[model samples]
Target chain A: MHNRSGLLEACLLILLKENKSYGYNLMNDLHKFGFEEDSLNISVIYRNLRSMEKRGLITSSWAESDQGPRKRVYEITADGEQDLKNWIWMLKNRKSQIETIIEKYENLK
Target chain B: MHNRSGLLEACLLILLKENKSYGYNLMNDLHKFGFEEDSLNISVIYRNLRSMEKRGLITSSWAESDQGPRKRVYEITADGEQDLKNWIWMLKNRKSQIETIIEKYENLK
Candidate 1:
């Protein structure tokens, strides 16, 4: 699979910014946001969360869950908010470029 | 750098569909089409051409040039045209998805 880890990271930032969340719930939220279960798994989400934490984009803390085990909850840092803004800018720029290419392809026909 | 090789291949197919072209000229055409020269180089063009040929998406033939060494010109095969269509479809789908994500982000603000 061509990993869309960049897009995944962007989505993660968006979710964390709204409210601090743990892994399992975040995965569910991703599905609600249009990510298919097959397209992403818990491992990928965890890896990205860890990477983002290392990059200072987010921070994590363990919280006691009412059930089974303690959960690691993630929250967006100030850096994460800035990165999300950058991602939005880049995505908008790329959308315009793709639009141009699509227009060119249509005109050729 | 994140390799946008897939997008590069789509652009190459579009150019080939218009008319057969060699690597150097194709690079220039890409620049005119909004791909920055720094974003793509001759080697990347040649690499994609070769890979596309391997996949039967394009075919190449050496043509003698009066001013320089013989150049390999590339043309889109029937499969290349089909692949180009697929690429456009995928790009359109991705554009919509990106738009959805952007909208979600804006709504959160």
Candidate 2:
């Protein structure tokens, strides 16, 4: 399942902004962020990429890969960069929420 | 919308574990953890509460309130407490995922 926290978009945005990459590479990279097989699916990432592209947050182009067929390479647009920044701010802003839950747990114990 | 991270159940579990509380109070307490007007809905909380109860994670009792009509007070069951612990561990484990995103953001600047 796709991460429902709505932060997956931010993750994709940040990844694309940092270095333009193909969908497969992007999907692989998402694993580091707790988007494992159980929680994430490649199709979901693709759908989100399409959705982001439609929203103009990202753009894609056909590019030849060394090992295989041509792939669609995604890059973050200026709008995507700004949206990424906002997402980071929001995540950092809400860091305390998770921390608060942790704190409550500690107190309970 | 309810928090889709699946941590909302943990939050509710923690609250009930700490002290048995009625629905309204539990809803209000959720705000401290980022469950606000935009992201959290009362109906969703109730649904989750019912789901948890059905799952044998929590139990509820009706109590007379001086302020008003009888209210259903919820308390965490043994299974619920264990579930809360598991959730805490999972959140802590995934905390780095968020930090990784933040780190990537910093590197981009």
> Largest lDDT belongs to which candidate?
1
Candidate lDDT values, in order: 0.83, 0.82
Cα lDDT tens digits, model 1, A1-109, are 2324256788889889899998888898887566655876789789889989999999999999998899999999999999999988878876887888799899998
Q: Which ten residues in a row have the lowest lDDT in candidate 1 chain B?
A: B1-10
Model 1: per-residue lDDT, tens digit, B1-109?
A: 2324256788889888899998988888887566655766688678879988999999989999999899999989999999999989878867877787788899999
For model 2, the superposed segments whose C-alpha errors exceed 4 Å read A1-4, B1-4
What's candidate 1's DockQ score?
0.52
Model 1, position B81, has a per-residue lDDT of 93
TM-score of chain A of each: 0.86, 0.86
* lDDT minimum window of 10 residues, candidate 2 chain B: B1-10
Indicate which candidate wins on DockQ. 2
lDDT of 2 by residue, B1-109 (tens): 3335656887898888878897888889888777666677789788899999998998899999899889998888889988889889877756667788888789878
CAPRI classification of candidate 1? medium
What TM-score is obtained for chain B in each of the predicted models? 0.88, 0.88
